[model samples]
Target: MLEVRRRGLTTLLGGTAVGWALAAHAQVPEKIPRLCFLTFDPGTLTSNRFGAFFEGLRDLGYANGQTISIDYLSVEGNGERFPALAEECLRLKADIIAVSTTPGAQAAIAATRTIPIIMIGLGDPVRTGLVGNLARPSGNITGLSLMVPEVATKRLGLLKDAIPGISQVLVLSYLADPIAPLQVKAMQEAAQPLGLTLQVHDIRTANDLPAAFDAAAREHAEALLTTSESIFVAQGQRVTELAARYKLPAMYCFSNDVVDFGGLMAYDVNYSRVIRRAASYVDRILKGAKVSDLPIEQPIKFEFSINLKAAKALGLTIPPGVLAIADKVIE
Candidate 1:
């Protein structure tokens, strides 16, 4: 009878231990956070921009495949596909949806109200109606603003400085972009004070590019300025080539790649830095911080890059003042 009781007690104790271990295992929360990254450009995920974002996550103790999973979706400049892509993310039950452009953010906002969205490098969240206010977004959307309208004036001023004698300036922009009209208006207002003739050449499609350049040449345009649209960005090489062919001194926003492709200059926000900063928002949101509580951020640092080679090719001398203030001068 003593042996039987001892065996039964041992068996009960072992069962209890097993049950406790199982309970502990079940209590361990899943550590992996799933992210859905949406962009207008299909190449964004592989570009240095998203690479910076990934690096930022790594800095915050999040690994892409191990601690987190990222789903990349790109519209490839097709705004029509945004809604479908956003819906797909929702169907996958993504923990967070990160968007880079205005259209993509808008789609994400329309797709679902519950899924958190981090808007990166957007022009103006409030003006675009992506958020209620900058200080308090009051919704799921909040991240960094590129300040495109404010910067548009600065870019126009820089172009004027680069080509002081340039009387006829052509503004190349995408007509469909929501921020394009604001930028064009800013350029128009800034041009009045500078005593410059600003002509608007809207490119509705890639095929419209050659005609736009022809129009610029026909108008005797002395310089060119472009809006920061994903279509233009994706066609950076072609734009730079056309500028070179026409010998038009061009100023672009948000792309040093254009300068590398032999374009004249670019003054825009530090894209990589903004994207890295966006990761912090993701980190906070993942940690149970409310999106409305996190204030929208504006880029504090801007990059001014000039290619001396391109400037020399155009036979235009960059002002010493402009060159001195440039953050990066590529030879």
Candidate 2:
């Protein structure tokens, strides 16, 4: 009976060890997917445009630090640093790299053809050589493209309507932006039919802003316009303040939030919608959707907003027709 008890005890101990090993294996946590958000939107993860992206991800059952982890690396509107940042993301083994500019996308693509890239709210991606086809991208690059020429036509025509006798307009743009030439060309084409001339100033940095404004004043420019870019987005307040100081009724691009920055008028892509769409793209990519399978998208939503207070400060009256067409009017 003692021998029988010993054998039974051994069998029980062996079963207990096997159960413990199984329990430990079951407790192991699964690896979470990681994403890297690159480029600039005023250097904050909480920037309104970026917030829209995260909100989209949350709606799709993603939570930061839970199902997915994200690292926001802002290059502060400098594209030269994009490659290094892309390398860092590669080192982190990021599942996706989302960029805000065409140059940023280029950098990521150049860094690795294997990793996926999403470009957000940039000019014609095809013209920029980021992709061969929109319906079906050939490589690992895809996202949203803003129709630059169309936006230019709309902005110039609206500016003409909003500001009477606005023959000469000042344009402040970042010279290093990949799409700067395209923006200039589009604006020039748009201006020709309106009988307006564009006086463009290259604003390379913050210090260049004052000089650009002074040049505009010296050139007798009646109004101001700016290309949508990360640099301008970063300096939205400063640009609006200078426009106010110069009494230059301005029309802006990119986001209507600039109107809140004291800008007179803004006609822009609904970046929130575009970026939120991007979140769906991100989700699809995480779920094994190939970049080549997703087509580059265009901006479906646009916003035209006017700040009545800004117009009043400039001693200008907006036309009833213009106000009627606006999506938002800030009093």
Candidate 3:
């Protein structure tokens, strides 16, 4: 009887040990997915683009360091650092990569074909050779495009309408942006029909801006027109200060960046929508959606904003016709 009891106890202990082992295995946590947001401008942290993305993540049941690990990476306005920044993302074992600028997108593409990349508001992805086509972005990269080249003519017209006889206009293009040359070309082409002379100067950094303005003055540019580059967006206030000093009427890419910063005017696509939509793409990719399956998105909403106060500062009057059409007018 004693021997039989000992054997039964040993068998029960063995079963309990097996159960505990299985329970521990089941309790093992899954690896958290990682994301990297690479960009050229770090100043956009307080901008609408940044707010929309993080807010979207929160709405999608994601909390940083809990459900997902996100690294907000920026080159601090240095395009040359894109490759290094992208490599850093790879080192972090990022499952998904998001880029706000074209250079960032290019670097990410160069870094990895397998890692899915989400691009936000590229001017012309097709022309830039970022992907094969929008419909079937087969390999890895995909996101929102504003098709900025299409609006080149319209932006010029708005500036001309706001300040008549703007024959000589300074085309403030940031060549460091990679896509700025194409944008400058579009503006040059658009200038032909309007009888406007474009003084295209490459603005590489904020320090170079004073020289660019000097070029504008030398070329006899009446008004300043900037491409949809983040450099200008980041340096809007400073640009406007220079414009104000020279009494140079200016038109920019975003409404708040212009009217809010005491600048002339802006006609642009809805950037917040494009940014938030990009965030949605990130969420989808993290949830096991293939980049190839996700189609590229285009913006439908556009905004034309004017600032009567800034116009007053420059001693210019916004035409009644132009003011009537403006979506947002700051007085």
Could you tell me the TM-score of candidate 3?
Answer: 0.91
By TM-score, the candidates rank as 2, 3, 1
What ranking emerges by lDDT with the best candidate at the front?
A: 1, 2, 3
Q: How many backbone clashes does candidate 1 have?
A: 0
Q: Candidate 3: list runs displaced more than 4 Å.
A: 1-27, 43-48
Better of 1 and 2 by TM-score: 2
Q: Which structure is stronger by TM-score: 2 or 3?
A: 2
Q: After superposition, how far is residue 255 of candidate 3 from its true place, in Å?
A: 2.2
lDDT of 2 by residue, 122-233 (tens): 7878887888989998788888888875686688889999876889999888868778778888889888788899999988788899999998888999999898677887
Model 3, span 91-142: residue lDDT tens: 9999999888888898999999999999888887888889889998868999
- TM-score, each model? 0.89, 0.92, 0.91
How accurate locally is residue 35 in candidate 3, as Cα lDDT from 0 to 100? 84
Which lDDT tens digits does candidate 1 get at residues 1-331?
Answer: 9899999999999999999999999999786889999987767445634688878988998887778888888887677798999999988789999998888888898899988999877888887788888999967888888888899999999899888888898888886768888888888888989989988988866788999999988899988888888878878888889989999998998665677778889998778888899999999999999998999999887889999999888887888999999988988
How many residue pairs of model 2 clash at the backbone? 0
Instruction: Output the better candidate (1/3) by lDDT.
Output: 1
